[model samples]
Target: MANNPCIIIADDHPLFRSALCGTLQRELNEPQLIEAADFNSLQTAVEAHKTANLILLDLHMPGAEGFSALVFLTAHYAHIPVMVVSAMEEPDIIRRAMDHGACGFLPKSASIEDMTAALTAALAGNLWLPAGIDDTPAANEAELNIAESLARLTPQQFRVAAMVNQGLLNKQIAYELNVTEATIKAHMTEIFRKLGVHSRTQAVLAMAQLAINPNSTLEAFRSQALPLQ
Candidate 1:
């Protein structure tokens, strides 16, 4: 069906890529598919095929991480929605991708029905997060008060908070920030207290929303915000 929508599939694994393409072809019937085996291939494909309606991306490619790719596409081509198709079940990664503007995510073990449903939901303009992952960016209360809370953090803490907001686990944050996991955990606890949040999801939602509208001054926020010890 030449009239059907077009999608680009970017995955490193041949078997999964082939299987996913086969399933999509069978189910979608008419949607055109462009396959990319790696990040370079995906970059090239994205440049050449600007008409793609959606992108199905794998997270752990060797050269370029899936998150970066998501950022690139969403920033450069804001009109095209990107969905993550990955095996990673980590809550933080899932949450991070959503914050970075992924339209949805499907685990590698997802059933055929689930995959089709997620894709359909995304195409319909819905954010495709898993059942319990809570893709609702507006559902968290902390997110509603981001501007006030970010001011409570010190410059270093702000850096840590940014990584945390990006969905990095404690260990990953530690590695990225050149600190121990324990340090990251401590910073997170302090962040939660300052932000009046209890969980990672809450912190993420709040921070992501703050990034969207960063009008408040960090110093002005510090003067009025309650101290968190």
Candidate 2:
């Protein structure tokens, strides 16, 4: 890590973030810390600090879906490492997070020692997972394909697709992203092409394949839009 390595703590809960921040400060000797209370801020932080050394993410941020943000971060910022520090510490969620691309998973309840160790390991280009979690039943071929397809999207396209997955219309997406509807429409077209989907609904369905819902391979299946074949 650099002498003043930058780390982004991307979690929404204020108290938990504070506690984690304190632990990192104590353990890391106050490395440059950036706090983001939501996913949009996370994006802004990453964009502003492209040379960041590590990102500690929470899966349930305001604008993020479980595992989806991890996928986006890992995809868009392949040079920087991401470690999940989430309250959803079940083995299944942890395993899914790893499958989607996070280099480490530290449950919120983990000891400060373990948390600091996780952050350090990820910065060192290593994988650090929770102890005693069985690593089995890895992500399936379809899920892998879905993740790869999503990795094809640019950072801006990923943001547009995330909003579309939330069921937002183009104009509303434009308003939120503060771009013209025509600009958003052009982005949607590229998103659809890269995702191999034909329409907004299909684009959402394609990105939803990377979400936390294990059951809604149904939507992807029905839409037949993923082009993972």
Candidate 3:
């Protein structure tokens, strides 16, 4: 069908990807599925097919690390909705995915029926979470403020910031992005201003604060939420 929707399935596991593709073929009406085994390929596919309807992203794919791909995509491609399809079923991980702007979280262990339902919900412009899981906002005010600051970064600034977080020098990032070191420096200046961080160390720490410690933060907040009359 020429009018069919386009979807990207980005997971490193071959069998898992095949299974997801098969499930989508059965559920969706002649969908155009693009498969990616790593974050680099995922980026290429998204760039090539700008009209993609949904992205099924695995959290641990090569080049993605943890939530780096999610953060980058959500920051850059806010128009395309993302649904995290990861084996990481930890509540904190799911919560963090949603907080980072995923429209849905589907565990790899989910049945075909459940997968179909979640995909449908996401395509219908609704948020989906595992059954019985609360969709409460996961991050506290301080953490959300950091996320908002990160979201404020332009696409190029976000890429440069991610490379910086990976300990890449300006020259290295410049070479990777095919731009001059001077351009990278200019982007860094804007990045620091948007993030309110004076130096690279502070900016990396700010991103880390948002990406790390969800479980501990949730536990602490839950403890505090307990009532004592």
Best by TM-score: 2
When 1 and 2 are scored with TM-score, the better candidate is 2
Q: In angstroms, what RMSD does candidate 3 have relative to the true structure?
A: 7.2
Residue 80 miss distance in model 2 (angstroms): 0.9
**Each candidate's lDDT (Cα)?**
0.70, 0.80, 0.81
Q: TM-score, each model?
A: 0.58, 0.87, 0.82
| Candidate 3 residue-wise lDDT at 68 | 65
lDDT of 3: 0.81
How many pairs in model 2 have backbone atoms within 3 A of each other, for residues 3 or more apart or on separate chains, i.e. clashes? 0
Better of 1 and 3 by TM-score: 3
Candidate 2: RMSD over Cα atoms?
3.9
Q: Count the backbone clashes (under 3 Å) in each candidate.
A: 1, 0, 0
Task: Tell me the lDDT of candidate 1.
Answer: 0.70
Model 2: per-residue Cα lDDT at residue 133: 81
lDDT of 2 by residue, 1-229 (tens): 4466688999888888888778777778458889999778899999999998899998887776557788888888988888988777778778888888788888888887787778778878999998898656566676677678878888888788888877688899999989999999999888888777788766656555556665665564566654432
Q: Please list all clashing residue pairs in model 2, or write none if there are none.
A: none
- Ordered from best to worst lDDT, the candidate numbers read 3, 2, 1
Ordered by TM-score, highest first, the candidates read 2, 3, 1
